[model samples]
Structures are given as structure tokens and as C-alpha cells.
Target: MIFNHFHDAYLYTLAEVYHKPQFYNQPRGNRSREVLNYTYGIESPIERICYVPERKTNIIFNFAEALWYLSGSNNLDFIHYYASNMSKYSADGRTLTGTAYGPKLFAYGDKRLNQWERIKEVLREDPDSKRAFLSIFDASEVLQLENIDVSCTIGLQFFIREGQLYMSSYMRANDAYRGMLSDVFSFTFLQELMATELGIEVGKYYHNVASVHIYETDYVQTKTVLSKAKQIGTVPAYPFPPMPLKDNRSDLQVVFEYEQQLRQGTITLKPVDIDRLDIDDYWKQVILLFAVYQSIQQKKVIDHTLYQKLIPLYQMLVQQKWESYFSIIMEEM
Candidate 1:
């Protein structure tokens, strides 16, 4: 079934997958796991683009992961800072061997042909081309015993139909409760970026997973989220502005630079610093949110005004649940 928002789609998938999970074994752990084969399509993939409140999705981690992929980085430091669990995926404890989709998309294999750049070039040359596929799974690395970080997503395919750009992502395996939200966030972000670069309207997104499952360890949490989904009521699709055609690469680069400086203690977090950024107002607000997150981590007082300004944006793009979540974050400080 097609859902208008990502949270609804995720909750629906979780409930269905949890109702009848099959016992199976995975490569990571020796214990038997519960899983299910599932497939679903999102009619408005980018609408209300955040996880359900019950799931307690980390906004910082989601945005940081998306930016990391776009930056073509494989360093554990970048992702580990936001999501500590990412460190476990590293094969040598230094770099992610094969599961790093960023490097694969922007600089893959020995020849280092940037798949994203290639996709843009192909689409620019032929808007209706069927060869606009970005491959992330590297069979050469997956076949080796030393490579432990194999990709879960096989590839992403883009199509241009009726003056819109549609994206379909294929995954070999998916953890319905733990992994699906972040995967969708990153992939759909990529889709929006591509559509913007191509100067076309964003279209529907299709996601197909060969194995979509919730582990036995997460059964209670899955059930809790499912139960809460009912009380959350039906969420309507939130309107989103069309992505601007002008390239925001330089603007994004500036954000990344500022983030790096803040992480390294070279620059102090301040609301005034956000005014120096040349990015769009929305991105400036997003950067400010990041700054607040950093302040929380550093035991500094959060700028309440920034958090207040960000609440409506998050509610519009994510969900109203974030309003309470952000309030809690601030209250604890």
C-alpha cells in the first residue's frame, strides 16, 4: 500500500512485519532472528520526512548521516560522533570496508568514476534515459572474507516520467525497526538533491526489500511504537517547497566546514555565527539546530530562540511529535 508520509509507511511496515515474523539466522550474530519479506511504495516520500515519535529517531544522526554520504566520506569519526553504533560496522576499526555508500557513489572502485556525477551527466544528456542507476554494492569486496561491511542496499534507480523524477531503491536486507528510517531518510534526500540538480519536480519513491525484519530483541519496542501509532491519529501530507534549481553545493560545503570547525574546537557555537552562512534560510536554521545539538553535548546553555524557530520547521517537514521531543531536550538542560 502507498502511504503519503514516511512515518506512516514505517509504522505500517513495522506492524505488518511484527505480526508474523519468521525465525532466521543472520551473519552478524549467532542467535536466531525474527524476520519477514516485505515491499512497499511511498506516494509522497518526502512529505513529513521523519520517524514516528514513538521510535525516538535522532534528528542529528539522520541529517549527519545524509551529509556524510553526500560528502563521500568513510571515516568512522564523522558518523561515529552522531551514531556511535556505526563504529561497530567498521571492518578494521579504522574505516568502513564496503558498506560506505558515500565513497561508492561519489568515488567507486579503482577507476573512481563518480556514480552521482555520471547520473547527472546522463540525465542532462538524455532526460528519459533508463541507465540512471547508482550502484552501491561492490561484489568484488563482498566476495572477500576480510570485508565485513557489506552494503544492505543493492542500488538506486531513477526514472523521469511526466516531468518528474522518481526513485526506486532496492535492498537485499532491511531491519524494519532499527534501520529503515535512516535508510529512507538518506536515500530520499539523495533523490531530492538529484531532482534539484536536474531542475525537475520530485516524484514518488519506491522501496523494495528482499528481507525486512524486526529482531526478537526489539519486539517490545516495535509493539510499543505500533500501539502508539494508533493514538497519533492520521497524519496528512505536509506541503514542501520545490527544491531550487540553483546548485547548493557551495552552501553545503560551507555548512560542512563550519561543522568540522565546531567539532575540532576551532570555533565556538554561537547564534550570531549562523548569520555569516551564505546558504538558504532553511539550511541556516538547520545549521543552527546542529549548533544547539553541539551545545547540549558540550554542557553549554542552548540558545532557546533557535530551538523555538526550528520547532515549526521540524513540525512541517518532520512531525508534530518533534515539538515535544525538542521541548524535552531543552527542559533537561
Candidate 2:
């Protein structure tokens, strides 16, 4: 709860683990320094992206991954397109059963209930009901050793108090570097979405991790990030826009369709074309992000006119991460 944005919380977690790790554990041969029962809160859940230049966080993958979860998909090929490293976690080499919380959150158990709709109903029926929980961990499914894709999230609970929707996510384990970055982004994105569905304001995000750590492999990169922050003296903040105040569930399918098309390289859209789409500006920006990523992947040069169409924050991050590509485009000016 000490940080207003994701950036500070992330740095705090890293500094804590780096300075005073209480334990050590190695899972799948990658050793890590650990801190047990770690917790933090983001006062502004929609301000979810961590835009540190040193780490070069992938905003594109974070957005795509969040949409993937909302779409209730567990397809390895889909996620692997954005993050190829995700393919390694596939239990059957086709889908991610344990790690993919989409199906588990949206449709789970005997009759394949829509847990999100249920949560909305529960909240509408009784706003203060603590039973509004969307669970991801199933003992029988994740207990087996053969499964490599165990989910980091245990469950998410929603609370509606003072006309704001607050969310708390419970995780059995969290890797404080790359894992926390993506986890916080998606979880808070989900938090904001739930708030939109409930017609409430987005409140703070609470993350409680039983085991939080920075993997040994990321130690050097972690140190570099910390050094950059120390030199800067203050973590920067950005006003990440909130979800549109409308029920966007139906439009998710449309987004997924376009996302699939872009990811497959079968279709491309210009910035103007995205603006012309009938969807809300929020989703339009999402599609625009997909277009930007597609341009990067295909190495198709994007001109200044089109490149500047992204929100200033995204433009900053994209240009920073893919400087060479964008530099070529900018130099053409």
C-alpha cells in the first residue's frame, strides 16, 4: 500500500529481495532468493504499467496477455506468439492448463459456469458479499508433478465498498521481476474490468504472495534497474487511462478476432483505420497496440504520422524498447 503506482511497488519488492532475502529455493534448476508472505498495494490500479527504461518492460505482451485471459483462452500458440518463452510451460505442448487462468476464472467446474457473470450477480444481489471470489487453483489439477504450468494465482476476490470496486489477488508464489510485472498488469487490468462491469470506480489493488522472489538469473538486470531508480531519486508516474464505462464483455470476442488476425499476419490496420472502428476508444487503442506490435514483428516501417498515434506513454515505451527499428523510421523524417 506504500506505492501509488506499479513502478514503485515493483522497485520496492526488488530492493527488499535484493537487500534482505530471508530464504532461497530452486525450482526447475533456476535458483532464487525469496521473501515469504510478501504483500503490497497499488492505490491506482489502472496505473498498472511499469515504464522503467532499464528493464524495457513489454507493454504489448502485457496487454495481449490480459486480453487472452479475458477471452478465456488457454491456447499456447496464441500466447507464444507474443511471448515465445510461454511455450515452455505447456503441459501438453498445445495448451496451458494450470497457468492459464482464463478458463478457470470465466468458466470453471461441473456445469462450466460463467464465474464473472456470477460475481456480477453476486455483487448486484449483495454488494458486501465476500463470497465474490474467482478461483484459479484446483488441488486435483495442480497437485500432479507432470504438469509444468502451475498457476501463480490462487484466487481473486472483489469487494464493493463506498461505491468502489477493490480487488485482492492471492498467489502461492510470485517472481518479483518479470513475473510480478506481468502479474500486476494483468491482475489490475482484470480489477479495472470488474469495476467497469459493476459500474463502480476502480480502487486499490492488494497482492498477497506466499513466496515472492527474484530469480537468480535476473539478479544483474535487477541490480541495473535498481541503480537507475536510485539515480533518478523518484519513480515516475503516468496516468494510465481506465476502462470505458460500459459493459465491454460482448466486444471482447471482436477484439480477439482482430488480435488473431494481426497475430497471424493475415490482416493489418493503419492508425486511422483503428480510429474508424465502431468500438470505444479504449478498445480501439488496444487494437492499435496490436497493429504496432505487428509492425514490429513484420519489420514493417511505421512512419512518424502513424507512429505518433499511440498514447504518449505507449509511444515512449515502444520507441525505447525497439529503438533501432523506430530510429530508422524517425531518421527517414
Candidate 3:
């Protein structure tokens, strides 16, 4: 289906497979409602968030995970902080072999090919080049053992048409419930970063999956989210900040540094400290998110002071995730 916003696409796809699946599948002992060759086109890539409260979408993890990919890192220590269970997917319990796209994006296995730079040069030299593609799944991965994390993505292709930059991602398989949301958040962010680097307007995002399915584990929650979505009142789409025009990839190091300190509970950040970060407000907001997570790590409560620093869109997302605590803080103040 072609969709105007990610929310609509998410709800439609989830409901579709639930109500009428092409087939029921158990790829690895987990039963799922599946649809083969499921595909979608998003008109506004920036509207990537699915604000359903039942889903408890973690905006912080979305941003942090995107940063993890952008930083070209495969460190388990870094990602494990956001989603502790992700450690299970690690091949050697340290760095992720298939799940981590950073190494492949920057310096791929064995040959150490920098696909990121190659894609940039490809599009820079010829805007209309169909060859501007990046491969994520390595052929050698076929030999990897079972139950390990393998890349769901096939590759990403960039198209420059009529001065707008569009991207398409092909995935071998995707878990429609949770994984698809994060994957879309990261890939579209990649699409915009490339567009910003090329100084072109961002265009539509095409997501094609060989098997798009929802696992049995999420069936109950899926119904709740859909039921709420179809209810009389539902969450409204908010204005998510666009990626800063600056090619801020170089500044990611600073972001990562502070993120490490936050994750380690090494330093407590006030709103003022976040404001003074040597980065744009767009990025400072991300650091502020880390600082808030720091509070949860060290104190298990959202810091009211730092929580006020978030933009209203983010405030809404965070509030939904930690509603009980958010209300108590509101009452105390």
C-alpha cells in the first residue's frame, strides 16, 4: 500500500496480516501471520513514528538505535544499554555479526569496503545513477549458524529523479510489529542524511519485504493497538523535527562520547549542560534523551528538569511511555 504517513501504513499492514494473512508461518518456532512480498511507499519519511500508546513505542530507543547505526559501531556494550535483550543476537557475545549494519556500511567484512562513501561518490558523479546501491546482506552469511541474527535487509538503492532524492530498501524478512518501525526510522534517517549531503529535497521512501509477518508473541498487543486505533479517539500525529540540514555525521563522535557517559551514569546532566553541548539543538535533544535515560538507569525516574527540555513532540512520546511517573512529576511541581 502507498501511504501518506508511517502511522497509517503501520496500522494497515498490522491489521491486514492479522485479519487476512497470505499464510501462517513459523520460520523459527515462533508462529506468525505472514504476507509474502509485502511492500509499501511512504510519502513523508519524517513521519516515521507510530504513536500508539498500546505499542509503547520507545522514541528514545529509535533515536539511540539510529545513532548506533550512524556511528558505524557494532559494540554490544553500546546497544545493550537501550535493549538489554539484544545481547542474545550477538554472535560472539561482544559484537553483532549480522544485526549490526555499521561495519558493513563503513568498512565491510574481510575486504573492508566503505559502501557509504562509494554510494556518495556514485550519486555525486552521476545523480541519475541506478548503480547508487548499498548491499547489507553478505553472501558469506549463508554459512552462519542457526538462531543467530542475520540481516533482514537485502540492500538499499538511491534514486535521484527531477532533483529529489528517493530511496528504496529491500528486506529478506521483517517483523511487522516492532522491527519494522525501528528499521523504517533508521533507513529513512539514512535517506534524509544522504539527501542533506547531496543538498536535494528528500522524496518518497519505498520499503519492500520478501516476508512481512507479525509473530504470535505480539498477537495480543497487536489487537489492543488496533482496537485503540479503531476506537473513537486515537493519538494524533505530531510534528517531528526534521534532521538538521548540516551534515552532522562528523559531530556524532561528541554525541557518542556523552551518550557513553550517560549510559555509564558517569555524569548527571541538567538541561543547561545539554544546552551547552558542542552540537546543534537537533543533536542536543538526542543527548537530552540520553540524559533522561541516565536518570532511569541511575534513579529509575524521569528527571523533571531534563524532561522539560524535550520538544513537545518528544514530550508526548516520552509521557506516553512513562505516564505514571510523568503524572506524579506534574503533580509534585
Q: Which structure among the candidates has the greatest lDDT? A: 3
lDDT of 3 by residue, 46-76 (tens): 8888877777889899988888887788899
Worst 10 residues of 1 by lDDT: 315-324
TM-score of model number 2: 0.95
lDDT per residue, candidate 1, 157-272, as tens digits? 99988898899999988888878888998888888888878878789998888888777788898888888778766574334433456677877887788777766657765566
- Backbone steric clashes in candidate 2, count: 1
- Rank by TM-score, highest first: 3, 2, 1
Residue-by-residue lDDT tens digits, candidate 2, 41-149? 8888887866678888788898998988988888998889889888889867899987788898778977787888898899999998989999888776756556777
The C-alpha TM-scores of every prediction are 0.88, 0.95, 0.95
* Candidate 2 whole-model C-alpha lDDT, 0 to 1: 0.84
2 or 3, greater by lDDT: 3
lDDT for 138 (candidate 1):
81
Q: Which wins on TM-score, candidate 1 or candidate 2?
A: 2
Query: What TM-score does prediction 3 earn?
Result: 0.95
Ranking by lDDT: 3, 2, 1
RMSD to the hidden true structure, all candidates:
3.2, 1.7, 1.7
